[model samples]
Target: MHNVHVITHPLVQHKLTLMRRKDASTNSFRRLLGELSTLMAYEVTRDMPLQDIEIETPLETMTAKVIDGKKLVLVSILRAGNGFLDGMLNVVPGARVGHIGLYRDPQTLQPVEYYFKMPSGMHERDVIVVDPMLATGNSAAAAVQRIRDMRPRSLKFVCLLAAPEGIATMQQAHPEVPIYTAAIDRELDAHGYILPGLGDAGDRIFGTK
Candidate 1:
């Protein structure tokens, strides 16, 4: 569990409860997701390196802390991840954005990558893979593997919610990378959905269903 950080912020918990209600509207769902992602981003970037630099202020020259080295690359895992991208970008406005498109095959329970395009200088940047729910974890695991192939300087997974099974699966597959989430649910349902989870994130955020 060293790599996993479960955020217990009141705002995150409150919005998550709102998101769980069956009657939550698409607009509300989308707005809550943005707010939650912004909070999660704070925890996600807590350990980001910082360096001190001398700067001239209105009064006099003083040392100031700034983000160190490589700028971050926010990699959204397709449609659902896009919801989180906006909020995270609001916090780290200068972070580069990337996309990885994947869909689960209903028959095989496998993730199929349809499209993936990342910033060219991945090796020089820290990457944060965003997805809303880490249920069965097949999609997030696959996405991480694909991103790893690019040899980024560092990589991490960020999600709004996760299931224990999915966390286990992810740890087994990529233990080196840390995972950050607002909550870790009890388990996955028979159909591989997180129990008591806020329905399909993409559908909820986009009103697709």
Candidate 2:
């Protein structure tokens, strides 16, 4: 847990519990994820640098703090990661967006990237990569390495859930990048799914199954 931060707010826990229910409707699950991501966004961006600027208020002129420079970027790790975009965007409306598409090979349980796209000047911008689950860590680590190549000012990984195996994989691969998650579940099953998790996030969010 050296570089990991878990959000334990009561509301976050409550919403997560609702999302885990087996009978939760796709619409309800997606809505809960959106709400939960909005809440989690507050914590992930807590350390954003701020600068003081003088502004005239209706009552008086005073210096106020605002985030420095351009807003941060939210990089979605393909299909499931997109589920976190709206909620995070709700809180940081000015944030730029990027996408990386990777699918787990059923036989090998490894990530194979099919697409990668990002904004310009990544070296000048902070980045937060979003994914619903970090079950295997291969995709997350791969995505992080690709982003690091762009040399962003700073970087963080945000996920709805994580597993101990996946966490260890990330720790070994990219120990410097901090990870933010709502929960770290028990462990991953043989097929690389979080135990007691909400099931396939992409399937749940998109009704693909």
Per model, state how many residue pairs clash. 0, 0
Q: Write the per-residue lDDT of candidate 2 for residues 27-90, one digit (tens) a residue.
A: 9999999999999999999999888999999999999999843559999999999999999998
Tell me how candidate 2 scores on lDDT. Answer: 0.94
Worst 10 residues of 1 by lDDT: 66-75
lDDT of 2 at 110: 89
Strongest candidate by lDDT: 2
Model 1 local distance difference test score: 0.91
* Candidate 2, poorest ten consecutive residues by summed lDDT: 64-73
Q: Root-mean-square deviation of each candidate, in angstroms? A: 1.3, 1.0
